[model samples]
Target: MTEEIIIAGFGGQGVLSMGKILAYSGVMQNKEVSWMPSYGPEMRGGTANVTVILSDERISSPILNSFDTAIILNQQSLDKFEKAVKPGGLLIYDPNGITKLPSRKDINIYSIAAADEAGKLGLSKIFNMIVLGGFLKLKPLVQPEFIHKGLEKSLPARHHKLIPDNEKAIEIGKGLIQAVQVLN
Candidate 1:
């Protein structure tokens, strides 16, 4: 199976890190993977996005014009990548920053209230992992064990103590995602 994914959000929101973790998880599962990140000039608060490709076979290239899944964290990303999702694909977004809801019938749409849920859990850093969990719940592209391993691999040793909290955030996200009505 091949999954091309785009994850987008404002910088400091862990957009790139989410993609990295996903890619790392794919690698841990013995899948071919690629990760590419883009961001605006201002590092902290600027727009940021990443493209990740995972496949059972060899990947041709990292560049892509469309994706099988789009994980949008903010309004800007929702606007930018909404149409980039392939027909019958998946579009997952966090409702916190979206001003305009997605209107597409050809693809599956889901909303994960990551920000609100993270706030409720008192976790400011594991927000992305929560969203990742929601996505996994919908897609199940990679195993949960791989995700845990990916967290261990992606995080620095000093931050390893927070793995349990991150795991909890992922579970929270899995429960929070809800399917939205598809527009015709």
Candidate 2:
């Protein structure tokens, strides 16, 4: 199976890191993976996005015009990538930053209140992992064990102390996601 995904948000929101962790997870599962990130000059407050592809077979290219899944953390990303999702694909977003809800009939849309839940759980840094958890709940393309291993591979040793918290954040995210819209 091949899943082409786009994770987009403002910089400092862990958009790139989320994609990296997902790519590493795919690798840990013996899947072919690719990750590509894009960010503006403003960096910390600027727009950031990443494209990740995980496949059981060899991947031909990292560039894509459309995706099987779009993980949007902010309204800007939703505006930019909303139409880029393939028909019958998945579109997951955090409603915290979205001013306009997505209106699409062909795709399954889900809302993961990552920011709100993270704040409630006092897990601000691992917000992306929570959203990743929500995505995994619906997709399950990669195993949770692989994600844990991927976290180990993606995080620096000094930050490894927070792995348990991040794991908890993921679980929280899994339970927080709600189906906003479903295609019939």
Candidate 3:
């Protein structure tokens, strides 16, 4: 089956990068994928969004009227896209950012405190990677190893050293989900 995921946040939160990494993982797994980014005039400080589609078969279109999954990194994003997810779709949000919980019972919503985890790692920028980790853990759409390798390849050669740290961020994100699952 194909999955369409949207990642959104204010600029500089790595919203686009999060979608790219997930799409790259799909490529590594031999899936057809597309990464489409939405940018506003202000670019960095403005609202940013990305749509990532991964399919076992050829992907027809890059535009997603609705999504099978969504990761919201800010309150505005959550309010804007939370209703766009398909019925019974999955939605993941950063608890640090979202002030209101989703009211739809048909959609599965997860509130993860990824910013706190990234802060503990001394890197607030890695919050996006943490959200990606939760996506992998809960959805099983792509392998973590594949995602890590894709991230390494997608980064600039000059910044290759950051791959290991990114992988660590992903791990911590997965750990958070696992901990919550255990609690439940």
> Per-residue alpha-carbon lDDT of model 2 for 11-123, expressed as tens digits?
99999999998999899999999998885585668889999999989998898999999999988899999999999999999999688889998889999999988888788
For model 3, give the 10-residue run with minimal summed lDDT: 175-184
Candidate 3, 30-49: lDDT as tens digits: 89999989865856688899
lDDT for each candidate structure: 0.91, 0.91, 0.82
lDDT of residue 128 for candidate 1: 95
Q: Report the alpha-carbon TM-score of model 2 versus the true structure.
A: 0.95
Best-to-worst ranking by TM-score: 1, 2, 3
Q: Estimate TM-scores for all models.
A: 0.96, 0.95, 0.91
lDDT of 3 at 108: 82
After best superposition, candidate 2 residue 55: deviation in angstroms?
0.4
The per-residue C-alpha lDDT of model 3 at residue 176 equals: 76
Candidate 2 backbone collisions, by pair: none
Q: Against the hidden true structure, what lDDT does model 2 obtain?
A: 0.91
For residue 179, what is the lDDT in candidate 1?
95
- Candidate with the larger TM-score of 1 and 3: 1
